[model samples]
Target: MGKIIRWISWLSIDVVLGAVAGMLFFSKLFHVALPWQPYVLLGMAVWCIYNLDHLLDAQKVGEKLSGRRQFHHQARVPVLIVIGILGLLGLVGGFWWFGWGLELQWTFLLGGLIGGIRFLVLKFGKGWMKEFSIALFYVIGISWLPFLRSNSLDWSAWHGLFFLLYLLLANLNLLILSFLDQEEDQLAGFFSVSQELNTVSLILWIKYLMYGLLILLILVLVIIPSFYKLFVAILFLMTLCHWYVFNMDGVDSEKKRIGMEWAFFLPVLLIFLK
Candidate 1:
């Protein structure tokens, strides 16, 4: 049972579910068939690989310093290998189906390479590199969606802005989890923003950041007025669910379980309501 729980935690199931919800929301918002459902699944696989990198690094650090393993030894290596292979396959399959051409594929490949390098660097790099890498991972990963959505290599400001907002929300979710892992991270010599700032200040900052982003989203809705009241209400309920998870302490297992399940359902709700 403990091992099962650990596996679920390492998978970051809530994050994957949230990504699925976001993708579905985008599909509805744009009225695009998003023939890229496979890509979204692939994106989740990539996320699993990226997360495995973190888990491996954490375990390595813990073992070296304390002479005791931190993360589950039996599961760590196998999960990492499996997820890495799946991520690679996902990338290839994504390119093949999406027909984004070599240039765009290369761009996406570069982002994945950066993420891999960042994983290694976090094991050895210092100060700004670590901080910069964390932010970069979020930017690159979220931007991959809009980039993949494009029919050509050419970029547009509208898509770029949307990607940026998506990345902001992604980082917001990550920061919340980082807060929960603050002690473990500090012990592993990881210098996350949550660790650098005071706890209360960190929480306050995250709250304001989320609030500001939501307000901006509202402004966008006002300007476009594309969605209906029901759509807005559904979005609001989704945000409320996320906020509930964000406020929960210590990565509560029950909350994680329930939140993961509900996150997926939000997109389904949008599909029906819209």
Candidate 2:
């Protein structure tokens, strides 16, 4: 039981769940009839490996706590290699399942490589790598390519608004997670926005920024008639809940982080239901 729990924690199961929800959102939005089973399995496998970047960082934290250097520094190399290979396989497999052309597959592969390089730099480079990693995961990996593939380069007011809103919400979510990691990140020498700015001021700014974005989304929905309003609402509520959880100051940080991540599925759910 202990081992199982540890494995689950190590795998960042909540993040995997959120990613699945994102995939489902895409499928529903596109009305794709592809078998979800393969996508789910492949997505989970790919995300699990992608998460090793964080797990490796956490391992370093553990090493700090134990005060004994146990795992070799070279251990992360194998994990990165495995992640790269599996990411390629998952990209090709997903595109194949969707009957998308080789072009889409190549795009995904290239994006994955770029994202992977960012991860590697974060792992080995200097200040704020972790925060940079979070941004890359959303802005580059999740929002940009997916939107480009789905909506194409057709420039329209509604599509542009949607893209902006998506990015705002995603960045807000990333900011909240960074806030939650304030302590651990400070200890780890990770210079996130939370660390760079005054903590209290940063939190306040983020809270209001997120709220403003949500309101803008709702207004856009009213004008443009998009179901994404519901999705944004759900995400906003979850962010509020996350703030509550953070302020409670009783629950463990890890638990709170995991819970917030799990709650991230609400946006995905909304996107799919639309």
Candidate 3:
């Protein structure tokens, strides 16, 4: 069971599920009726991005590849073949599933552009950039469809607030992972936000991020409509889970990573609520 969970997390199946849950949460919140295509495409895109990132990292580090990266390294060829097939399918299916309205076209274009940039950053860039870029793109990928479908086109302040809160939540998760994997990353000679700060400083930053996320979640809960309050509540719980996982003594980083990834799936509960 543990190996299964680790493999699921390693392949980023958990992340894809979490992304779909988030997309559905927003779609329901905004009263938009989304087809199945968006969900499928989003899942494929997320899995590809994450696996590619892992594969890239795995290729770079020789003996220092972490457990997840090492798995990716061992299965590199199969993973690459699958990613290529999915990418091609997603491209063709996207065009078929979402007709070429200018809005849809622009949406795909922007997403592809950001994804390209993120891939480049992973290959050449180091430090906080990779973490920040991944967080930004993840939020955008999950929320953009629902936002586009929303009745309001004015880009209301509340919409901005909601996405901001989510982005922060995503960033916090990445930071915690980076902190947990700091030792392995250093062994692999990989740079991340953790590498830029001392242990004390990184812990301090994580604490600050959690506090800020807590307050922001509460503020959004208060100001957003009752319809959207549940989403904020879900985020609040996710934040608490992160705090718990990060502070868990005697637990390894891989377990912490799994815990945090599971937290993101809380949004799936919204489906039952509806």
Candidate 4:
């Protein structure tokens, strides 16, 4: 069961699942319910890009199969080959389906650019910059729909507010994941913003930021009570995930990562909602 979970995680199926969830969130918020088929290509694109990131990082590891390095030992070559072909196909298919509109095109291109740029910054940037840069990359990657569709942000509507909320959640997700890997990152000589602060300070920062976002979300719910169920579902998941993070002694890091991934997988739960 553990190996199966590892395979699913390493193969980036969770990423595909997260992509669909993100797409659904966008569709629901924007009132633009695009067909589900496009997400397959988008998810594949994400898998490819992530694999490339994995491959690059693997180069820095020793012969040991520690951390994410173990994924390479399982199946490196075939995965990269598939990632290459599918990544290109996903890009082409996306352009063909979503059009070459200025906004959508910029979002697509900028997303890829950010993915690559992150590595360079991580390798060379100051420790203080790591968290903000990481947050920016995820926000751009997961919440690009607003930038893709709008001439300017429309915060008066729920869509814009939801987009910002996604960014905040994305930041929290990355921080929690990094917090789990602080030891591995330090041993590997990698730069993570969490490295700049003591564990308690970092955790406090994350907790305070999340509370602020949660308050804003609750306010949004008050404004649009029709979405009360959705926001409440989110609130529940956020609370659950935070519990796991705040009590890591009772739960292992791997389990915490899975719990957090479920947050990204939250939109999948909407199918069963009333």
Candidate 5:
């Protein structure tokens, strides 16, 4: 189980689920069938960038030569090679997906810029800035792909609502990951929101996030009847996540992260329902 989880993490398959979900949002809401290129672009960008983050972690873990650190260092060359290949693929896919269009190119560029900013902030900035940047970029990465091909720049109420809910979900996901990395972040002199908050305060914030999601679920219940099943599944999974955070998987950060990634798969329930 641990090996499987670790493989998924190392391969960054978790982020693929995110990319897929993002595409699904656009497809389901806008009735736009995004091509495979966008999915590949988003998935590979995430896979490349996430491993880069881990490589940085290995470096920052410092001098102790823990197993992870050793593995990261040893795998550095291969990871860099993979990133290069993925970047090349992204360039090709961008052309195929967007053509000579300016709007889509700009959107794609903006998403990359957001990812770059988050990378810089994670390296140098502290506290809520990094977390917010991460969540924002994540939303941009997946959402913009769908938006690029939209008939208009303006999103409808359904689009807006879905974006906000997904933003909160991404934010919550990053917070949990940040909480786990708080200690390492401290050692590396990086500030994280989790580092600043007391445990009780963090718990309160977590509760607020969970409640906010619940409220969204309730809204879906009353308002977005078509998405009622999808949101309900999200709510249930999120509640279980909140429970697992304090009581079950806090100690196993990798496993916790894996679980979070897998949660993205819940949206597939909509497919089955249909």
Candidate 6:
């Protein structure tokens, strides 16, 4: 079961599932009834993007690789093929289902442009903004339909707080992964934001992130309306799980990565809570 879960994480299936869970949770909170199309599109897009990133890393890294990188290195062709198919489906099906509204147009335009720029940057440029960009994109992708269906372009304080909580959780997950994988990335000649920080500094940053997230979670619990507080609490639990995994000693990076990956799925509980 452990190996099976690791394979699911390595293949990025867990990420896609977590996105779906997030979408459902946010949609329920906003009273938006999202159809099947957005879920499918988001799932495909996330899987494609993650697999492409892994595939690129696999090709770029040196012979010494982490287990995840080595898996990507060995399965590069098959993963690329899957990414290609899913990418095409997401593009075509998105247009067909979303229609040609101004919002849809701008969303796709910005998503495509940013996604392209991000790929190029990851492939060749520095990693300063990589974690944050990925986090923002993930939150936007999961919440786009909810925002639209809610039909309120104007964000209330509660809405903004909820969005910030999700973004903070996502970035914390990435930062933890980056910190844990720093040595492996260094050994593989891979570039990550961690490369810019010493071990002490990175640990300090992770600690600060956890404290910030905890503060945000508290604000959210107090400020968000009662209807959404349950969802926020679930997110808070997810954040704590990541923090615990990051602080664990004598654990391998792969296990920590898997723990973080699984933590994101905790929001699925919101569906039942609703």
Q: Candidate 6: what lDDT?
A: 0.83
Best by lDDT: 3
Tell me the spans in candidate 5 whose CA falls farther than 4 Å from its real position: 63-70, 115-126, 152-155, 225-246, 249-251
Worst 10 residues of 6 by lDDT: 151-160
Candidate of highest TM-score: 3
Worst 10 residues of 5 by lDDT: 61-70
Report the C-alpha lDDT of model 2 over 33-122, residue by residue, as the tens digit. 335554465465646555665556656665563111123233456656767777677756766665576646665686678778776765
TM-scores vs. true structure, each candidate = 0.68, 0.69, 0.92, 0.83, 0.84, 0.91
lDDT of each: 0.59, 0.57, 0.86, 0.67, 0.69, 0.83
lDDT of 4 by residue, 1-274 (tens): 9887766776667766786677766655544545655667667867876677677666676546454566764567887888878977876777777787875667767867876777677777767566767656655565566345544443345555565677677777777777887777777776776668778887787788777766766676676757545855564476456655656677777767776776677776665662
> lDDT per residue, candidate 1, 1-274, as tens digits?
7566455545655456555566666555444455655546645664675567656665657444321134434456776777777777776766766579774567678866986887687676653355556655655553455455655544445445555565555556556656665666677766666556667876786798678777766776576435444445454455566677876678764445446335434755776666
Q: Go through the candidates in order and give the clash count of each.
A: 0, 0, 0, 0, 1, 0
TM-score of model 5 vs. true structure: 0.84
Clashing pairs in 3: none
What is residue 144's positional error in candidate 1, in angstroms? 3.5
* Candidates by lDDT, descending order: 3, 6, 5, 4, 1, 2
Deviation from native of the Cα of residue 15 in model 3, angstroms: 0.7
TM-score head-to-head 4 vs 5, winner: 5
Pairwise TM-score winner, candidates 2 and 5: 5
RMSD of 2: 5.1
Which ten contiguous residues of candidate 3 have the minimum total lDDT? 153-162
List model 6 lDDT by residue over 101-196, tens digit each: 876887878788887977787787767577888888889888878887785654567777788889988888888888888888777766687777
Residue lDDT tens for model 5, 1-274: 7787677766677777766776665565555677666676778877887878778877776545434455667787898798889889877777776786985668767866876887788677767777778777777667775676676745567677677777787778777777766666666665689667866776678778877786766767576656445655554575466546535633676666677777776665555653
Error of 4 at 163 (Å): 1.9
Alpha carbon lDDT at 88, candidate 2: 73
